[model samples]
Target: MTADDTVNQPSIALNSEVSAKCNEVVEEYRAGTASKVDAILRLQSIIPRSDDTEDQFKSALQSYVGMLDSADQARASAAKRGEQHDRSSSKRPRSPPESDDEDISEKPAKRSIDESRLPWVIDELLHPIELPPSLRLTRESLQLWSSNPKQYKASLTNAARCPEFPDSEWSNIIESKPINLDIVFAGHYSTSFDNRRTEKLGELELTFGETKPSKRIESAGDWLIAWTKASEALQFAFPHRERELREYGSYVTQLFGAVHPSRHHRVLQYEKAIRRRVSARRDLSLTDFSRFADLHLLHIDSSGAVALDEDSRPQARPNRGGDSRKRPGKGVEACRRWNEGRCPVDAARCRYTHICSTCRSREHTAEQCTNRARAN
Candidate 1:
């Protein structure tokens, strides 16, 4: 054989080997056998030095190095973000629930949530007992956002979802929003994976608690989780709409339902407050249609329930649901806003029949609760 043909064979064989290795990595990654980190290291190990690589091997070497660099960069970006998340989460202490008997500390409070001696929050975030396939959320949405920040911004803006906060406002926008659900679907960029992980630890950054402002976002995460979980509840609550979005009308309601998290958040919040314990969600009574699936604001007051839309009233109410509890009488009622520990400044004049928020007595506020004092 010619000397030239003999020389070319080895390079071709080596190039094929390199390509084969890369293909193996792709398969392992896709099959979930190898982690991104593992895959990166494997690719990096085979990359040759450009300076010493033979001319034939140079092209393959550059390709190898290029992949190695990209994987390293992606790995670093993801790791940095993971560290940030770890640092942020580690700051939260899982101390026992707060007690009235405990001494007040001059030191900074761990969080803003006033746990216990209150009405309720789900033991954990509540998802509907069953989930529909359409509502299955994944990181793909965030991936799209990450690949093109501008596209994410415009889509979120057009959908009326909050865009990622600017660096300046990131720390303090928790209170700028009315409720945690307002930012329930809030997305943030991960430098490690260059991902915009949505609703998946999304709360590490902020919260939408109607009850408290965030400091370390621990309480905010809880609040955000509570609100975020309501998405599935809404879907389960409204079958007609779910069916419409799937089978009938403009999918506008469905699109908005999935995208507009706060509206559902508010509806569920109201339902929880109104029902107190044992939410049967009877008769779509939980739905505040004005806000539910509505694409635009309509001179609405979020403070209390608004009138049902006439056009929607006939068609909107679900005919039946699980059994409901009796409405609380005015005199025996518990004020949820008061229990939240974030009652508006004008609460004294607030309309509602009332008993003590702490002890369920009519005599006085929780601090001065006559029943507790008597028991003590």
Candidate 2:
């Protein structure tokens, strides 16, 4: 055959193979060996195409199967009539268009988007600018303004006459007394007084000695106002001593001292509890329970306690219970879990030696094995 004929022959063979597979699948479905849906899937797997084409293959397969059903019935009826009757016209199947319409109705149409208009669409983009924090005019600034009444009043009047001062702003300021003389001076004055001026004025000198009791009583009038001023000046003058001054004539110190111990204890206890919890969690995750399955410890010391496993090696452990040996001379076996004659000792000062059954490795006793060390 020519090359063209050979290619065509393969195509025909492929079509025949696909048809045979489809028939085998339909037979499986009819025999109750496989469901109709699974048969459709098996038929689709034999074809080389995407998932979208599977439905089309299923429709064609179903139409062919329906034709086979009709042919079987026609043959059965024809055999009974023999050649005496001809039912060719009556037996002819309907056109496939109706079946195609039924399949098309079962599948919904997919919608596609138009991408051409995407670039022309306008989107509103917002750029937000955060205003820097407005400078806070403190009581110090207002105090300065109050000290210089003329300057303070002039500044307020100028601000009120400015175009930026709206009617609402003016009314609110006027009603609420917004222009505090102290805060105005706070804004104008430097954080520190110039040392040059104080030195020049000879006001740098301070009288430290205490005056008479009568004079102390006399200064009470101005003292009240000075003491009642805001935290800024008091903090500046006294530094760390201000909080003590603020709590003057109150039980602040006594109260603090009274509850301080309990508070300290509570805080320490909470920290210890947290540490224990974290350690317990870590131990739980790292612990190998399987390794300790057969672990047993024998204790044979009186003054101290040690663990010994079947290996006969000693391992140190924390002391929870009191010493087992009542007298320093009395022999002791302190491992509560000790079984049979095996006894362990605290390796720190343990004198006697013993053996372990499970681990076979030997050193101090049954209580001292490394495996028991890890186990208990």
Q: What TM-scores do the predictions have?
A: 0.19, 0.15
Q: Per-residue lDDT for 289-345 in model 1, tens only?
A: 443433223212343333233223332222246433222344346766544434432
- Pairs in steric clash, model 1: 77-191, 77-192, 78-192, 78-193, 180-208, 330-353
Candidate 2 per-residue C-alpha lDDT over 217-335 given as tens digits, one digit per residue, 9 for 90 to 100: 01222223322332233233224435433543122223234434323222222222332332233122112323222221112122212222312554333245654322222233333
Q: For each predicted model, how many residue pairs clash, with residues at least 3 apart or on different chains?
A: 6, 29
Root-mean-square deviation (CA) per prediction: 21.5, 38.0
lDDT of each: 0.38, 0.35
Question: How good is model 2 by TM-score?
Answer: 0.15
